[model samples]
Target: MTAEREAEFDFTHPFYQTGLAIGVPREDSAGILRSLGALLSWQFLSLVAGLGLLLLAVGSLLWLVERRRNAEQFGGSPAQGIGASFWWAAVTMTTVGYGDKAPVTLAGRLIALVWMFAGLIMVASFTAAITSALTVSNLQRQINGPRDLPGLRVATVADTASAQYLTEQRIEQARYPDLPTAMRAVADGAADAVVYDQPLLQYRNRELGERRLDILRNTFAEQLYAFALPAGSELRGPLAQEVLRVTESAEWQSLMDAYLGHR
Candidate 1:
């Protein structure tokens, strides 16, 4: 139903509400530069920094265990041995296994063996940490709700209440011919979001079947679907009473679920 205004036909008590919602692509549709930029965010950088520190710590421990007795591989001045150990730690963690260095002492060999497994575990953890950081950064690029629409490429159906709402908020938008096109615009990276009726967006997205889009849970500028009648129609009062009764009934809920889905 069209969003109601008192100047038009008389509207009965609202039987259903379809609020305004934001729709965005399921995956990050940002450009390569944007993706690289997201990868450089503080969280990801911190993880890399932590990994560097962990490698240095492991290398220093190995250097201490080998410097005295097994100096041939882990020998030389303190700085040189630490540098060699650091190189070993880097290559071993990455599984490159250069095979140039070997620890000969019992304690040194034990430290090296322990570090091999520890490096594997740390590398796995570091990879997971980076992936999580990137995913989080990608999600942050997607809008959380209406508050994020400002300064973003907002798409909406032309000549709609949603467009009007955006205008009222002084938000510039790219108006499309219809909802599907607006949704497509977001998927195609032409727009950041599609603002439309909640239930309508839900139904349309389900039709896509690819889960290419995700609708924000938050709804704003709610619109009510009501029965419209001729102005001052004699049936308005009685019809409103019936609508309220039916809409409030359990059977009505079951019917809604049967047709519209279980929300």
Candidate 2:
């Protein structure tokens, strides 16, 4: 082949190639991206769904406890009824800006404002709690980290992305229902390493002080942590996109760095 023809066919060149060398068509690329998008969407929706349920539960409880006070303050308005109180609490918790049915009277408005701010704090606290809980639950599924070493029978949390990665790599994997069991397996010499999310790894690394375990330098995949739900849910895609946007925002980045460090 002429130098020009060689250059034209040089898909492996450091800078120039725009298409896959293995002849994966653009359609295939799109399909792969779509599948990944779906997975992310599932996760995001799961988080939102969990939070939404929590908000409903909390809002109901709060409204019930505060309804009598609110009714008296609202001049015996039925707006202080359980349903209305719950609605107010929901709107306040999520910070959803629906202009309908806000407190019109001075005392009612002041109470509403207080409730609004309270809702904000509660929602934030609830979200953090849920995330922490889920992270802990998710981490329990994976063994520690790094499976490539000999005699290391690493395990991942069942149904997690890490497990999926192992299956893709043809790596033999053990699945566990929870972290304590997985850790016990390691302590018993049943597994050599554990492959799990960074949060889980960090938490365990702290908990396993004085242990002789080695966390590997080699990271297998950069799986995005997300809420999971059944496929094709309506809230999935929008929630995923919102989460991605938030994650990419400067505030999100700072929060991540504060928690996970600058890396």
Candidate 3:
């Protein structure tokens, strides 16, 4: 779940305005860059694919060894035995052994021992890959609310509510003419993150795919959208009532679904 902090923007506060910022250490920058580079490298992808193929090959080998020798545990027709072998390989590789099946043969046990060690290496690589993917660059994982915006390169569209909010909070930001450009800044590494409307950010993130960008679940300084009217307009009350009525109807839901999907 997304964690939210208070929306109060204290412009006069030293923490919000200016101070000696405690940023990610420069010493760790090289390691973080290396990790990110590895994650996006072709070599890493090849290694992952090779490991997957190795798992399948080991599973097939196990099936060949146990199918005839131990028919009861790894029993059934050739196809079924192969399927069981795959199940066993998967469980063993993940270290989730159920112990319902085992190989009694010497050769099979030797293969299992080798596979166990290989699985350890594979698992360690997978964990490192996931960690590198998650902790990309210096933005560790503390970005939960607007208060965390200090010392980060933030982007937003110019002349929008988000831009105004950033200004009021005395937060440094890069302003773009449009949402796409602002989001692209984040993706291109020109900006560390983008702050904009939740729906627009969500739609853009979906379009860009999670690997390219992601939207933070928590939102701060929420504002209500309203229609503007001429001063002393008599139609205000009726219009407001009708707006509420229509928004509560199925038609509004259908419109939302058509535009933004169920998400």
Candidate 4:
């Protein structure tokens, strides 16, 4: 079925017709988790810590150079001098020279120039790292939407709505027999990304473990999953009724929570 027809049927289908059946709740939960994961990731945290340490080291060096030679501006107990050095380093690194604290010695000014350039590079690198990790929607700033599909090596399962959509869009794609293989193609660098059902992709991501892959928050072409039965089957109505009953039950809600927790 076309995505539009499938979406219409999903809203009316017994499996999704209950009053509590909100649409695409899993996507919202996944988004929250992804954001949390990015912020708490060890790699990003380590980079921040390293930058802080580097700044402190530079501050310490500055205090040593100015401790005896330029005693007026940096004179006092070692601790006070180090504190002043730190403040200078911070202000200079951020390119916000308040001019309140100036290094008088030639050695101090030379060190300041080096630290300034190093700080500039470090800041740019850190910003790039954050942008790469958190901006999951645009993979490398390439795949913003379905319209940006051309020239990308997309992967999707055969006989799925995603495959059909790719065909209609005339986007280059590698069709796999199942979701696992399609996802693997992306992980293995054979494809730029995998396009599939959002909930199923989220489940797969959980199974694969943390942050190995990213899913785009923007979903397109919604569709419903249904059980296929023989034409004019006598059991269809009874099965559908059972599905409706189970879906609305507390037990079923618990099961859903277990699999896909609330955001």
Name the better of 2 and 4 by TM-score. Answer: 4
Cα lDDT of model 1 by residue, 1-263, tens digit: 56356667888898898789988877544656456766787877887888888888888988998888878888899889999989988998888989998777787678778888987898898878767766765665568888887887899999888999999988879999988888888777678788988878877776666645788888999778888888899999999999989988889978876665544
Q: What lDDT does the true structure give each of the candidates?
A: 0.81, 0.52, 0.67, 0.68
Tens digits of lDDT, candidate 4, 1-263: 33555444432233531111111112333555656667677987988798788778898899898888867767699888888888888888888889877776898889988988987887788789888778853342255567666777788889867777789888877899987777766666567677777667755666654333566667677555455555566777877788778887889977765775432
Write one digit per residue (lDDT tens) for candidate 2, span 55-136.
5665455454554555542223444454565566577667885754455456555656776787777778767755665554
Instruction: Evaluate candidate 1 by giving its C-alpha RMSD to the native, one decimal.
Output: 9.6
Clashes of 3: 0
Q: What is the C-alpha local distance difference test score of candidate 2?
A: 0.52
Taking all chains together, each candidate's TM-score versus the true structure is 0.56, 0.32, 0.46, 0.45
Q: Of the pair 2 and 4, which is ahead by lDDT? A: 4
Ranking the candidates on TM-score from highest down gives: 1, 3, 4, 2
User: Could you tell me the lDDT of residue 260 within candidate 1?
Assistant: 54
TM-score for candidate 2, residues paired by index: 0.32
lDDT of 2 at 211: 47
Clashing pairs in 1: none
Can you give the lDDT of residue 142 in candidate 2? Answer: 36
